[model samples]
Each structure stands twice: as structure tokens, then as C-alpha cells.
Target chain A: MAEIQLKDLAHSYAADPEHTTDYAIHQMNHVWEQGGAYALLGPSGCGKSTLLNIISGLVKPSHGSVLFDGVVMNDISPQDRNIAQVFQFPVIYDSMTVYDNLAFPLRNMKVIESEVDEKVRAVADILELNSILQQKANNLSADQKQKISMGRGLVRDDVSAILFDEPLTVIDPNLKWKLRRKLKQIHERYNLTMVYVTHDQLEASTFADKIALMYEGKIVQFGTPRELFENPNHTFVGYFIGSPGMNLLEIEVTAEGAKMGEITVCLNDQQRRLLKSAGNASLKLGIRPEFVQLSSQSNDESMPCTLVHTEDLGTYKIVTVMLGEHSIKVRLDEEQQVPEQNAYLNFPSQWLKFYADDYLIVTDETGDKS
Target chain B: MNKIQNNRAWFLVLPVFILVAFSAIIPLMTVVNYSVQDIFDQNNAYFVGVEWYRDVLQDPRLQDSLLRQFMYSGSVLAIEIPLGIAVALMMPTRGAMASLSLILLAIPLLIPWNVVGTIWQIFARADIGLLGYAINGMGIEYNYATNATDAWLTVVLMDVWHWTSLIALLCYSGLRAIPDAYYQAAKIDRASDWAIFKYIQLPKLKGVLIIGVLLRFMDSFMIYTEPFVLTGGGPGNSTTFLSQTLTKMAIGQFDIGPAAAFSMIYFLIVLLVSWLFFTTISQLDKNKT
Candidate 1:
């Protein structure tokens, strides 16, 4: 495995290069280190899959260069790239036995019969496909077929990397965990540079060592899952990565502090300076639902909100509230006593993120808002 | 959910079965009647029992025609199926080109069977036809009309031209139905082009190829119109396949008893062969179990 570098890589479906901004990827410059398990996570049509395909050599970028260990691979075919891919659905040969399906790539490379058998058996063992090795691949269930598809990719040890494009979409929810666990085990054992594309945050976070969160046609943020959750550079990432997502309430900033309607919340000196330097008139406050505390009685600094309803989701309750016209959600503790009609909303002492024009403005801990 | 009474569903299928029976059963019964009774004319007839069947079973002409039919179907299938797959593999997956290729392929299938024969007959003539003229111009003695080997070549070539496209189209449809993920999986496996075809494309194409084989087999084995129009079973009966032989006994000589026996033998051979093909393929599909 060698480091794959994307140098100002951008792509457009159009014939001519419009601009860097006009491209789907928009000048992405990053290195996926050798043996790293990375994920391109985003919603539909966000250019995450495009980036994955480019790395796999299935697609060529409109601008910049893709370098594999410092050698240009911009025009290299997928076969020449030494990469394997598992698709959204099963791609196993229906007529061939599971064993043959697994052995195919090895045979193509002109490996001896005994070696092919050994390798096929090894992959089949990893995939828990040993029981059905003699069976035809088409007769298998969707999950089994997908396993064969995965096995076909995994069987070849010579591949530089393996790519997955929503490989679990066709799999049953109950079986997904098992398959994912199996995949993780195989990745750990093989240490192939793996790039996965998925819209599911949980899948991305669980599978990838580092996640590249894409928005529109650009990578909004690339970081570890913990870093993404704790510190989002863009408001979109903050909103996208969390369940009950991050609440972004528009606020007005003045010389005194940040104001929402008649309420004015004071900011510390550094935060005030940061807001002043931001230059954008529009301000927004974002925080995870887990951080917001709800109570019956208001504190002097607490924001007032009307209790709408609460949804019991086993371990936690998602309490909905109407703050002016906007609905804010708070994840209330399962064991905590329910708050009354009028709930006072207290933003967590830490984890307050301030944004200006969709870009992060200030992320301060310790309630000081610096 | 409302419970559905499925008895009404059978009513929908009634018309189709009735139509098939009318087209199939009446002709079959008439053939049976002819196979048993010797009819000197429309008015004069006598019960021949199994005599006609025995005679037909013993005929060398019947044996030759049956053998030729199998050979023709076998050769055509062997050539067409793989060639079709190769052509399909080379075709574009999407866009105007795919649709254009489909329309172009469907043109030969749309032409009347008799017209295909006529077209080939004219197209392979030495004096006027381009193919014949070109071949002769190449300093090769080529006359499909007079030579047995040339006649066989012309017939086989015509068949390939007429039917290979059909198999290709079927294979193309199957290939199109394959999700892009499979290709990706193959790529990830580091599978070579031939490996992809053998393991991925070929397996995916089995259903279509089965249909192609069955359709081509039935058509080739019962081939009559084209050869009938082109050679008229000439060049010393070298191109007289089963259907043409049956036609001669049934229509030209009007020997109803023997003709009926001959046709039943022809029909049984087709039925038995087709059943064998179907069962064998289906069993192979099941063996993957």
C-alpha cells in the first residue's frame, strides 16, 4: 500500500473546465495514507462517490492530479490502479459456484490451481461463506450475494486498496452489523487502503478511521469522528453529523452582545472580538441536542421556550420545544423527571458554536463563549 | 389487508389457453388423423394403422433430414451464442448509440421469414448479387445455386446473419440489466477483462442465452422458408432440412398418411430435443444448489 494524493482535484460533467468552483469536488487536496481506512460521507449527489470513483480510477478528474506514491495516475485505468470495489448491490457471478466466484481473479492472474483453491478457501472462511462454497452464487440471498461480491474483492491479496460504495444498502438491517463487523475484521487483518462512500453517518463513523464529510460538491470537513462531532468547521457538518442534528438559530449581534428577538446574551471579550472581526451581519448559534438542558424554572441567562411534545425513544426522550417560530429539540435523560409546560432552555456550559454566513465563527468551552 | 379470492385470476388465463388449443390442438388432431388413414383422394380413404409410421421411421430421407436439422441447429447455436455475447460486450451501456444499435438489430427480425429467404437468394446470386460478385471477383469459384458445399455455406451464413443479432440483442438486454456494482466488484477483485466476461457477464447472461438457444434451435431445426425459397431443396437434396422434407411429403406428393407420420416424427423430434435442452439447462441451474 502507498499513499494516494489528490492534488487540487476537481471534476465536472461538462466538456470544458468551467472553474474550480464549477467542479463537483472543487480543488480537493488531501492524502489518503497507506493502509488507512477512510470514508467519504455525504448525502445523495454530494460528490462523495465521485471522489471515491476518482480514487479508484473509475473516473478521471477535470483538473489537478491523482498521485499514487508520487506517480501520476490521472489516466490510469481501474485495473492498473490495483484497487478493488464492492458496490451497493451484489455483483457475484450467478452461474459460477461461490468457490469459482472467489477464485476468478486469482485464476485470471494465472495463479496455479492449488493456490487458487487455497486463496478461495481462505476468503470463503473469512466471509463465513464456507458452507455455501459449492453452491451457485445467484441462488444465494441478497446478503450472501453481497458477501460473495465482497469476497471476490477481498480474495485478491495484490490489490493496493479496496473501495466500497454503500455496500450494505441491499443488506438487511439485522445482518448489516454482522457484515460490517466481518468487514472491519478483514480490514484489520489485511490492512488494505480502503475508501468507503456512504450517506449513513453511523455506517461512516463505525467503519472509517477518518471521515471526509462532503456537502454540495465539496468536502466540507475531513477529520476523525470525535473531532467532527466536537468541532465542525462548517455549520453543515455540525447539522449533518448529529442526530436531532445541530440546531442553528439565527441571532443578531450588536456592540452589547448576541441577541435573539428581545433577549440579549452576553459574550466574553474574545468572542466579542471574534464576532466583530467576522464582518458578516448574520449570526447563528449551533449546539447538539444532548448539550441543551431543560428545566421548569428559568435562570437569568436561560432562554425561554414552550414545551411542544416529547418522543420516547427507549433510552432517551427527544423533547420538542417552540422557541419563537423555530422548533428546537433537546435530548432529555430517560430517568430524569419530565419538565412542566414552560421549559427554560439552558445552552450547555461548553460546546457552544457560533457561525457567520454558514462558516464557523467561534467554538468556545467554559460558558465564557470565547 | 383484504383477503383475495384467487379463483378469478384463472379466468384471465382462459382466453390464452383457448386460443392456443384452437391453433395447436386442431392441427395436431388433423395430423393424427392423417397419420392413421391412407387417403387416395378427398373422397377415397382407408385405415392404414401403423404402416405409414413404420415406413416413415424406416425412410433414409427422413434420417438424413433429421441429422441435417440437428447439425444445422447445433452449429448455429455454437457459433451464435458466443458471437452474440462478444457483440453485446462491445456495445455501449447507455445513450443514443445503445438505442440505435437495438433498432438496427431488430430490423432483420421484423422482416417476414419468406422475405428473408428471397433477399438472401437475390443477394447471393453470381450475376447480380454483391456478395456473389465480390467472392467470384476474388478469383474463387463460388456458386451457392449449383454446388452442395456452397449451398450449405450460403444457408449457414444466411442463418448466422439472420439470427446472431437476435441472440446479441437478448444478451445485450441481460447485460444492461446488470447493476453497475457488479462491474465495480470485478474491478476491485483485479479481475482481467476475460475473467469479468467468464465469471460476471457470462453467468448474468445465462437466462437470455437459454432463451436465445431455445428460440434459435426451434427456428433452425424447423427451417423451411429460406431454403425453400433459395435452393428449393435442390443440389440433390443437400439443403432439404426436416421441415422441408415434411412439407414435400405433406404438400407436394399429398401422401397424407405418410406425410402426417413424417410431420409427427418431425414435431416429436423438436419437442423431445427442446425438452431435453430445457431440462438439461434447468438442471444445470439447479446443480448450482
Candidate 2:
């Protein structure tokens, strides 16, 4: 396995592109370590799959270079790249047996018969496909067929990396978890450089060592799952990486503090200086619903708000609050009795995130201990 | 779920069944009747039982035509299947260029069968046609009208040109139906071009290729228009296929009894082959299920 490095990479489907906006993927540079498991996570229409394709040599980026072991692979064909890919749906030869499907690559490269058999059997064993080795590949169930597809990629040990493009999309939900676990186990055992791309936040977070959060053809943040959850660098990342997503309330910043409609909240000296020089005095405060504390008594550091509605979500109660015409969501404990009337709510100062001009302004990182 | 279930929908199919009964079934029944009798003329006929069937089955011409038909169809399929797939492999997979290429490939398929024959006939003439003129100009003797090898080559080439597109189109559709994920898997596997084709493309194409094979086989077996238009059974009987020979006995000879028996045998052979094809395909599908 080799470390994959993407340098100044930008791809544009447009001809004679004039600006960065014309590109499908904006310029970015990052390195995925050798034998590392990484995930490219984004919503549909984002450039996550495009980035995967570029690395695989299926798509040649309009700008920048992709390096495997520091060697530029801009013009290399996919076959020569020595990367194995598993698609969303299974791609197996129906005419060939499962053994043959897995052995085909080896056979094509003119590997010796005895070795090919050994390799095929080993891959089949890993994929739990030994019993179905002699059966035609098309005769397998959807999930089994997908496993055969994975085995076909895994059989060849010489590949630089194995790329999975939403490989579990067609698998049953229960089966998906098992396969993901199996994939993680395989990666750990083999130490293969595996890159998985998915739009599902849970899949991305749970499967990869590092997750690259993407939005609108750009990689907003690439970090560990915990890092993404705790300190999202961009507002988009904050919104994307969470369940109900982070709630951002627009406010006016001043010397004393910020004003959210009629309420004026006090800020510390450092927070005030940061907001003053933050270019636009207009700022937004972001806090995840999980971080928002609901209290019965009013506190000095808390923003007073009224409860609007509560949705019981089995484990917790998702309480909606109206703060000066703006709506915010807060999650409360399921066992706790929800405030029935015009009860006051509070936003903890430690959990507050400042945003300016739609970008997450990170002037203050002193409060975060996690 | 509470929508009306109307029986009036059967009216849409009534006209088709009537047309088919008159145009297909009645003529088939008439042919069946003639196969079991001896007819001297339009009016003078007698019941001769299976005597004619036995006599026609023993004819050497019948054996030759059947052999020729098999060779012809087999050769056509052997050449067309791979050639079509190869052409499809070279085609662009996306954008306006791919669309344009598909439209261009579709042109040959849309051309009338008799017209295709006429085009090949003139195109292979030694004195005038481009192919014949060019080959002769290159100091090689190539006359499709007068030579058996030349006639066979011309017919095979003509059939390939006429039908390879159909196979290619079917293969293209199959190839196009494959999601990008499959290619991704192949890429990461470091699968060679041949591996991708064998393990991915060929298996994916099994359904359509079966259709392609069946259609091409049936068409090639019953092919009377092109070869008849091009060579008229040739200088000898070198190119006289089963369908042509059957037509000759039924129309040229006008010996109703033997012709009827020949036709029945021809129909049976086609029916048997089609049944074999269907069963084989169904078996493959069943194994998959």
C-alpha cells in the first residue's frame, strides 16, 4: 500500500473555464497515509465521487496532480494504477463461476494456475464465498453477488488501494452493518489503503479513521470523526455532520456583546475583540441541539427563550424553541418533563460558535477542552 | 386500490387476433392440410398420407440446403457477435458524441433488407462495384457473381454489415446499463481490460447476447431476401439456403405434395431450434434465481 496524495486538484467539466466556480471540484491539497482508511462524505451532487474517480484514474482532473507514493498518476490508466474498486451494485460475470470471477484478474495477468487457485480460494474464504465458489456468480443473491464483487477486487494482492463507492447501498440495512464491520476488519488485518465514499454521515463516521466532509464541490473539512463533531471549521460542515444539524442564529455584534433581536447578551473581552475585527460586525451563533441546555431557572450567561413544541424521539425529546422570531431546536432527556408553558431556555456560553459572512469564524478556540 | 377492473380492455386485442388468424393461422392450417395430401392441380387432389413426407425427407437437395443453412447461420453468428461487441467497446460512453455514434450505428439497422442486398450486389461487382473494382485493380481476381468462394465471402460480408450493428446495439445497451460503480470496482481491483470484459461486461451482457443470438440465428436461417437479390442462388447451388430451396420447390417446381412436406420440415426445424434457445436461456435464468 502507498500513500495517496492529491495536490492542487481542481476539476471542471466546462471548457475554457474562467473562474473557480466553473470547476466541479475546487483546488485542494491533501495526503492520505499509507494503509489508512479514509472516507469522502457529502450529499448528492457534491464532488465526493468525482474525487474518488480522479484517484482511480477513471476521471482525469482538469487541474492538479494525484500522486501515489509521490509519483504523479495524472495520465495513468485505471488498470495500471493497481487500485481495486467496488461499486454500489455488484459487477460480476454471470457466465463465470464465483471462483472464476475472482480469479479472472489473476488469469488475465498470466498468473500461474496453482497460485491463481490459492488466491481465489483465500479471497473466497475471506468473503465467506467458499461454498458458492463453483456456482455461477449470477446465481448469488444481491448481497452475495456484492461480496463476490468485493472478492474479485481483494483477490489481487498487488493493488495500491481498494476504493468503495457506496458499495453497501444495494445491500440490506442489517447486512450493510455486517459488511461495514467486515470491511473494517479486512482493512485492519490486511492494512490495505481503503477509501470509502458515502453520503451517509453515520457510515462515513463509523467506518473511516478520517472523514473528509464535502459540500458544493469543495472539501470543507478533513479530520477525525470526533474532531468534525467537536470543531467543524466551516458552517456547512457543522450543518452536514450532525443529525438535526447545528442551528445558527443571526445576531448583531457590539463592544459589550451581541444582540439577538430584543435581548442583549454579554461577551468577554477576547470575544468582543474577535467579533470587532471579524470584518463584518454581523455575526451568527451556532450550537448543536445536543449542546443546547434546557433549564428551569434563569441564569446570567443563558439566553431566555420560550418552548414551542416537543417531538418525542424515543431516546430523547426534541424540543423546538422560539427565540425572538427565530426557531431553534434543543434535545432534552426523554424522562424529564417538558416545560408546558412559557418556560425560559438558555444557551451555554461554552457551547457557542461564532460565524461571520456564512463562514465559521474560528478566532476563539480556548473554551473547547475536548 | 379501489379502481375499476374493466373487461372492455380485451377489445384492444380483438383486431390483432382476427388479423393474425386470417394472415397466419389459416395459411398455416392450409399448409398442414397440403403436407398430408397429393395435389395434382388447383382442383385435382387426393389424400396420400405420409408418403410425400417420407419422400421429401429422403431428398439429397433437402439435406444439402439444411447443411448450408446451418453453416451460413453459424458462420454469420461467429463473425457478428464478437465483432459487434468489439465495435461497442470502442464506442464513447457519454455525451453528444456517444449519442451521435448510436444514431450512426442505428442507420444500417433501419435500412430495408432487400435494399441491403441490392447495395451489396452492386458493391461487389468485379467490373463496376468499389469492392470488386478495387480488389481487381489490386491485381487479385475477385468476381462474386461467377465464383463460389467470392459469393460466400460477399454474402457473409453483407450479412455482417447488415446485422453486426444489431448485435452491437444490443451489446451497447447492455454495457450502458452497467452503473459506474462496477467500473470503479474493476479499477480498484486493478483488473485488466480483458478481465473487465470477461468478469463484468460479458456476464452483464448474457441476457441481451442471448436475445442477439436468437434474433440473428432466426433471421439468418430464414434469410431469402438478401441472397436471392444478390446472387439468385448463385452460378451453381453454392449459396442456395434452406428457405430459398423451400421457395423453389413450392413455387418453381409447383409440386404441392413434396413442397408442402419440405415446408413442414423447415418450420419444424426452426421451431425446434427456437425451443432449444428458449429453454437454454430459461435454464440460465433459473440457475441465477
Candidate 3:
């Protein structure tokens, strides 16, 4: 296995890209640690697939080099890269049986027949496809076909990494869970570096140790799921990660505190200092709906907002409150009480994230940009 | 639990019944009637048993034409299928170039059968045409009008030009239907070019190729127009396919009995061969053993 490094990588579908918007992937550097499970998470058309393809040498980046371990691999083709990739849809050779589909890669590399059979059988065993190994790949269900696709990568012993591009999109919910668990088990057993690309936050969070949140052709944040939830480094992550996501309001930074229009909302001492230091940049105050508390009556620490609506989710409730002209969502536990009237929104200072020009500006306790 | 049965659906089939009777069944039965009998006129007829069938089968002209038809159809399929697939492979897959290539390929298919015949007839003329003049200029004795080999060559080449596009179009559509992911996966797996074709492209193109093969076989077996116009079954009937022979006996000679029997045999051969092609190729994947 190898640590995949994308250094100064930029990709543009256009022959002459005039602006940053034309690039599918903007110039950036990132590294996937050897044997670590990482995810490229983003919404559709955010270049996650492009990044995965670039890593696999399927698509060449317009600028910069891809390094496997430490060697530059710019001119290396996908065939020479020793990378394995599972695609968005299950791709199998219909003329071949399940066994042959799994055995194909090893056979291509001129591995011996007995070794091919051993590896194929082992992978089939892990995917629980042993029973139908002799059957034609065309006859299997979507999930089993997908398993065959995944099995091809697993059968190869010398692959540097296995890339998955939304492999479970066609699978049913129950099978998706099983296949994901199987993938995790395979990772644990082989210690292969894996990068899964998906639009789904849940799939990203559950499958990868560190999720790289991408937006507008850039990696906005790369951290654990909890880190992304607790300390979103970008405004997009703050909006993208949670269920209702972090409620945000355009705020003006001042000497007293952050102001959301005429009323000034109270911020913690550290946050107030951070906002003041990040001067002249457009400011936004963000807090997860889960962190926002609802007070029955207005208080000095609370902002007065009208209770617009409440949605009763099975485990929790999301209440929408109109704070001036902005609608902010406040999530409450099933047992927690919502105000009858005169709702006051309390922004817990610790949970609040301040953004200057759409970037998270929070510093950890040690004065580091964590 | 008991379910109520509705017979109303059976009554709804009346329109289809009327359509099939007029279009297929009644006409087919009339041919069968004509094939088994000797009829001098509307008022005079006699049941001749299998006499006409036996006579038609023994006729050497009919036999020669059948053999020529088989060779022609075989040669057409052998040349066209691979060539069509190659052309399809070379075609652009997307964007403005793909659309332009598609339009250019469709030009041959859009020409009517007779028009194709007329075009090739003048185009292959030894004295005036470019192809014939160039071949002769290359120190080759080529005149489709007088030589049997030359006539056969022109007829086959004309047929290829007229119909290879159909197979190519079908194959192009088939190739386009395959996702880019297959090619990417193949590259990642380190599959050779030949291996990719053998495993991925060929297998995916199987369904469309079956249709292409069947259509090409049937159409080539019944080929009459371009050859008729270009060579006129000339050079001692070297290019006379089965349909030309059937047309000659039925309409040219007006021999009602044997011609009907000959036409009947022609129909059966096409039906049987089409059925064989369909079943054999369709079952190729299913019966792996």
C-alpha cells in the first residue's frame, strides 16, 4: 500500500479555462495516508469523482503531479499505477462467471492459475459470494454483482489502493449496510489504503476515519466526523454536515459583540476577540440547531425571535424561529419543552462558530487554527 | 379465495384479429394454396400434390441460384460484420463530432433501395465511372458487364456499400450504451486492448450484433436490386441471388405452378434460417457448456 499525495493538482474539462469556476478541481494539495480509510465527501458535481479518477490515473490532472508514496506518477497510466477502483455502477464481464470476474485482475498480471483460484475463492468467501462463484456474473442481483466488482480489487495482492465511487448507490438499504461492513472488515484485514467518494454524509461518516469535505472544487475541511460536527472549518461544512445543519446569520463584527442587524447578539470573550482580529472580512455567526437553547422569556443573554413552526421528528423536533428577517432552525429533544410564546434564542458561546469570508476562524485552546 | 374471471379481454382482440388476417394469415394461406396446386386460370385448377415442389427442387437454375445466394449471404456477413464493428469503434462517442459522424453514416441508409441500385449502376460503369476507370488505370482488367468474376465483385462491393451502414449504426449504438466506467475499470485491471474487446466490448455488443447479423443475413439472402441494376444477373447468372431467380420464374416466365412452389421454398428457407440465427445466437450465452 502507498500513501497517495495529490500535489498542486488542478483539473479542467475545458481546453482553456478562463476562471476558477471552469476548473472541475482547483489547484490543491492533499494526502491519503497509507492504510488509512479516507473519504472524499461532497455534493454532486463537486469534483469528488474527478479527484478519485485522478488518483487512480483514469483522469490526468491538467496541472501538477500525483505521487504514490514519494515518486511522481504524472505520466503513469492507470494500468501501470497498480490501483483498483470500483465504479458508480457495478461493472462485470457478463460472459464470465463470478469466479472469473474476481480472478480477472490477477490473471491479467500473469499470476499462476492455482494462486488466482486461491485469491478468488478467498475474496468470494469474504463477500459471501462462494455459493454462486460458478454462476454467470450477469445472472446475479445488483448487490452481488457489486460484490463481484469489489472482489476484483480484493483478489489482487499488490494494489496500492482501492477507490470506490458510490459503489452502493444501486444496492438496497439492508445490503448497503452489509457491503459497507464487509468493506470495513476487508480494510481491517488487509490494511489497504481506501478512498471512498460519495455525496452522502452518513455514508462518508460511517465508512471513513477522516472525511474530506469538498465544496466549489476545493477541500474545505478534512477531519473526523465529530470534528466536522463540533468544529466545522468552513461555512459550507457548517451548513452541510448536520441534519438541519448549523443555523447561520449574516452578522457585523463590532467592539461589543457580533450584531445581526439592529440587535447585537452576545458572543463569548474569545469569539469576540477572534471576530475583532478578523477585521474587514464579511462575518457570519453559526451554531448548530442542537446547540441553540430556547428560553421561555426574553433575557439579556438571549435574542428575541418569533416562533414560526415546529416539526416533530421521531427522536427530536426542529423548531423554526424567525429572528428578524432570517429563519433559524432550533432543534430540541423529544422531552425538551418549546416556548408557548415570547421565544428567546440563546447562542451558547462554546458551540458558536465565527466565519470570516466563509472560512471557520476558531482557534483551539493552544492558539492553533485547529 | 375465489377470484372473478373476466372474458371481456378476449373480445378486445377482434381488431388485432382483423389486422393479422388481412396482413399476414390470409396472404400466407393463398401462397400455400398456390404452391400445392396447378391453376391454368381463375376457373381451371387441379391438386397436383408435391409434383411442382419436386420439379422446382430439381431445376438446376433454381439450385444454382440457391447456391449463389448462400455464398453471397455468407460473404456479406463475413465482410460486413467485422468492418461495421471497426467503423463503429472508430466513430466519435460524443459531442458535435459524434453527431456529425452519425449524420454522415446515415446518408447511405436513407437512400431508397432502387436509388442505391441506380447509383451503383452508373458509378461502376467501366468506360465512364471513376472506380472502374481507376481500377483499369491500375493495370487491372476490370469490366463488370462482361466478366463473371468482375460482375460478382461489383455486385458484392455494391451490396457492401449499400448496407454496411445499417450494421455499423446498430453496433455504434451498442458501443455508446456501454458506460465509460467499463473502459476505466478495464484499464485499472490492466486488461490488454484485445482482452478488453473480447471480455467487455464484444459481450456488451452481443445483443445488438444478433440483430445486425439476422437483418444482414435476411436482407442479403433476398438481395436483388443493386445487383440487378449493376450487373443485371449478367456474366451467365454469376450474381443472380434467389429473389432474382424467384422473380424471373414467377413474373418473367409466368409459370404459375413451379414458380409458386419455388417461392414457397424460398419463404421456408428464409423463415427457417432466421429462426436458426435467432435461437442459436440467443442461446449462446445461456448454454455455456
Candidate that scores best on TM-score: 3
> How displaced is residue B227 in candidate 3, in Å?
1.9
Chain A TM-scores of all predicted models: 0.94, 0.95, 0.97
Q: Evaluated with DockQ, which candidate comes out highest?
A: 3
User: Candidate 3 has what TM-score?
Assistant: 0.95
lDDT of 2 by residue, B13-38 (tens): 99999999999999998888999998
After superposition, the stretches of candidate 3 with alpha carbons farther than 4 Å from their true spots are: A254-256, A297-300, A363-368, B1-11, B95-100, B125-129
Q: What TM-score does structure 2 among the candidates reach?
A: 0.88
Models 1 onward score TM values of 0.91, 0.88, 0.95
Question: Of the pair 1 and 2, which is ahead by lDDT?
Answer: 2
Candidate 3 residue lDDT tens string, B28-141? 888778889999888989999899999999999999999999999999899999999999999988899999988888999999888888887788778998888888989999
Q: Deviation in angstroms for B97 in model 2? A: 5.3
Superposed model 2: Cα runs more than 4 Å off: A80-82, A296-304, A364-370, B1-23, B40-44, B92-104, B127-130, B137-139, B142-145, B281-289
**Cα misplacement distance, residue B98 of candidate 2 (Å):** 4.4
The top-ranked prediction according to lDDT is 3
lDDT-wise, the better of 1 and 3 is: 3
Candidate 3 residue pairs that clash: none
Which tens-of-lDDT digit does each residue in A1-370 have in candidate 1?
7688999888887788666556777877989999998988999988888888888888888889999999999988887787788878778776678898888878777889998899899999988999989887767899998888778777777787888989999889999889888889988999888888999999989999999999988888889998788777788998899887888788878776777776566676776777776786577878888888889888877878888899999999999887767788888789975687667888764567778888876534323321
True contacts kept of each: 0.79, 0.72, 0.84
| Residue pairs in clash, model 2 | A83-B188, A84-B188, A84-B189, A85-B185, A85-B188, A85-B189, A86-B185
